[model samples]
Target: MLLNGLKVVEFASYIAAPGAAGILADWGAQVIKVERPGGDAMRHVFADAKSELSGNPTFEMDNRGKRSVVLDISKPRGREALARLAAKADVFLTNVRASSLKKSGLDEPTLRKANPRLIYAMVTGYGLEGTEAETPGFDVTAFWARAGVAMMTTPKGHDPFLLRTGVGDHTTSLATVSAILAAVYEREHTGVGRLVQTSLLATGVYTVGSDLAVQLRFGRLASNKPRTAPFDPVANFYRSADDRWFVVNPRGGAVDWPVLTKVAGRPELTEDERFRTSRSRKDNSALLVAELDAAFGAMAFDEIARRLNEADLAWAPAQTPAEVAADPQLRAAGALVEVDDGSGRAHLSPAAPAVFPGLDPGVLPPCPALGRDTRKVLEEAGFSAADIEAMYDEGAAA
Candidate 1:
């Protein structure tokens, strides 16, 4: 319960913004999710999938342990209720477009006017000041397509593929959390909250900063090559006799060359002119990769693993999701946790990417049903029951 006393008012939908608040909730923050009537668009994602599953784990992952209050800020009463909630909150988070938020009087200036100590955090696709600032963007467009990730990741001459669901959004979510916490810390001294902004484009750029750095320095970057003709043959995947795949990344220079050569049962390769140095290996990568492929393919994965372990080589299996799900190390690393969904049951879900030794967040409460806490939250914000009922009657608050 590290953030036990913190209050986060989340006015966001989908992943990035809501996901940030989710991590805070995991650490014991009291999060109030202010959804528009009908709930977040994420609630319909599973329905769009046409799946037979009874639950929406994807939406639940980012919305768990929160109280929901439906409010249509397009109406005057809804905006009044939201402003009152913000007046007493520690943080206000959203991904609504800047123009729209300003129009609704929920922008930083408007909200901060009522509560100088409210932390206003926002997530955007491109950024806040660009010409396309108001342009609607999703992770696929801003993070992957516009940020050079898709180009750099796709192999030369290969068709580009979509990024796995929520990869970029969740990465942006973590960045937003980091920014929000930093602002929270700053508030301790300033006695005032600050505006914290994070964007998909920026996160995507940072994600591939190393590659971008090379491109920046050289004005160009080498296109990705297929595994067979990888730029570095020593760092490549190979198949075993049983057809299992594993990747190896041996040490640079001649340090691990002799060991690798011996382990491959081809000690002469260390002395071979084409494979003598790192540069030469790169120059003749395809040939070296072929040799390694043959050598590894001659032995079963178990035997290959033993030799690699004996040599202290760096290698790992290309594990499938099912394998990773059942991996004992995943639990040991605290990468997953069981969440109580208030259905008299607990389900396994991925944990936030960090751990506080003593502040362990064991089992979390369920994500609230849409508008389940509207009356309670409104009353906590100091609204009278009659006032809350009036707003509900007017379709302002539900």
Candidate 2:
């Protein structure tokens, strides 16, 4: 609850920007999720299970634990209202395009002038001055496909594949939060705000650091399969008889090497020239893996699991989402939480992900429906009831 006193104003819609605000809210920031008069377009992204056209889990996921303010910032009065909110904010953020930011006067120069102590965080597909700046980009198009994600995920000659959800958007949002926190820390002493920016494309490229470095220096990178073996010999994922997967990287000082040797039942492997030293194992990784396959494949999953555990080698059965949801260790640690809404106790998926001193960061409320706090925020901002009504009449109350 250290963030209990932090104030955040968000001009965000989908997961990339609003999702970051949601995490801040979970840490106890008073995050105000701002949107257009009708609502964020993402509010209609996915219909609920009940009606194929009604519920939107997307909006619920990103805007949780925040107040909603409907102000049509495209309008002159709406822009003025939003600017007023920004002036008093500690952190202001948006995924809106650079052009939109300039048009609405929320660009760095304007916003910074309004609040010198405010941290301005911007999320976008491309950096502000790039040639691709004007093109619209989503997580899938900009981060996954155009970037090397499709290449990294699929084999050398296979068709490209997209991830099922917004991996890049969510990841970049967390990065943006870190940037904001750094700026906030600086502001505590200097009282000067700074602009922080991130892009899905850049983050995607940064993700493959080793590959990028290799390509940059050598002009190209060899695909995994083309280099002989894709698996890392003894350190990659392996499926057991029960379909449970286990991954381990046990070569270095594998004092537990005997455990693996015992599990392998190939006691001769210790003396085999191909498996003698770590360097030899890596060089002949493919051959060593074939030997392991022959050994482990002969045993039952339970037998092998028991042996691995007894051997004191690091190993675990593959767990699915359902299995992880019910994991005793995570539950005992209170990593998951159930919070109460006004109607019922709803299980909120995580926003803030770490624990401190055996305590959760904080509790997060469910996302507010659009405009749910318009009147209240207006009142807090000293807008008279008549003024609020007039603004609504003028199509400025989004």
Candidate 3:
């Protein structure tokens, strides 16, 4: 309820922009999603997939609790309607390309001119000012590949794999939300809104910033390796007797090596010459890893977990999706909530990351059907019934 009275008009599809607005809505903002006629491309994105589902969970995740309006912005009347919406919104959010936005008169300058106090937030694949500003980019190309994350994450000789859906977009959503809130705060003092922007590429770069920073200063980075032969053997995964994998992150400066050796029931190994110093252990990483593999493989997961905890080692099991879904810690932390899908069916849904103390993060409504609020939104924007009818009849509004 922190942003109870805030109004956001979102002109974006897919994940990034709408995801950001979804968080705003979670915090009690009234969000109006402006989609093109036939609705956002996301509506049909998974249509060809073979699955038994009543609704698109992906679409619902980013668009729930928001009103949807369909308008063909290419038409003058539709563009006029969008401008009217922007004029009354505290924030106008979009992921539409800069070129298209300008062409349709929905760019920052135009919208800000209409409402000086509006926060004009733009999400893009690249950025607003560049040769590729208008270039269409999805999270795969811009966020993963172009940002160097794909190359960095790919094994030394393996083909780069695509990221899971919305990973980058969701990350960028957090960045956009932070920027929007800051801009909102600034507007209180300046009495004017500003153009705030972020890009998938930029967000990706920041996500891998520590790795990229090392590469930038050192001129090169260690090649990606298989999990079994990671650069730091102490920071690696091992399988238990039960065949469950878990990761260990030993403390820096060789502080945890002796403790971990004892926990693995191989304290004698600490006296070995090849594993005495940090540099020596790294030099004999393969041998050290082999020993660790055998040691962990001999113990059941429960025993390994108990020993790791007893030794105060930082480690966690590599949980599967099913395991994650049943994690009591996640539930206690409010990572998921039950939401009604408008069919009187309550489904478990992901909750926004932020937690405001003393405030209930209210349940979200289901994603609206295509053009579900077109006429109502137009009416609220001060359009007369006759005007709304004419716009619909002229193929401008749906």
Name the candidate that leads on lDDT.
Answer: 1
Which portions of model 2 show Cα errors greater than 4 Å? 48-58, 218-220, 226-228, 251-259, 277-287, 332-334, 358-363
User: Ranking by lDDT, best first?
Assistant: 1, 3, 2
User: Which whole-number lDDT from 0 to 100 does residue 187 have in model 3?
Assistant: 96
Candidate with better TM-score, 2 vs 3:
3
Winner of 1 and 3 under lDDT: 1
lDDT of 2 by residue, 1-398 (tens): 76888999999877888888887887789999889876888886764346645445566767777999999887777887888888889999988888878988988789888789889999889777768887788888888877777787676776777776768888878878888999899998998999998888887887766787888899988765422244346565566666566765565664655557777688788768887776777778778777776677677788888877777777776789888877778755656655435355666464456566655544457778889998898878777889888888998885
Show model 1 residue runs off by greater than 4 Å: none
TM-score of each: 0.97, 0.89, 0.97
Over 1-398, each residue of candidate 1 has an lDDT whose tens digit, in order, gives: 88989999999999999999999999889999999999999988888676676778899999999999999998999999998999999999999999898998989999999999999999999889969887787889999988989989998999999999899999999999999999999999999999999999999999989999999999999999999999888888899999899998888767888898888888899989999988999899999999998998899999989999999999999899998899998888889989997787998899999977866677888878899999999998999988998999999998
Q: Which runs of model 3 end up more than 4 angstroms from their true locations? A: none
Model 1 weakest lDDT span, ten residues long: 46-55
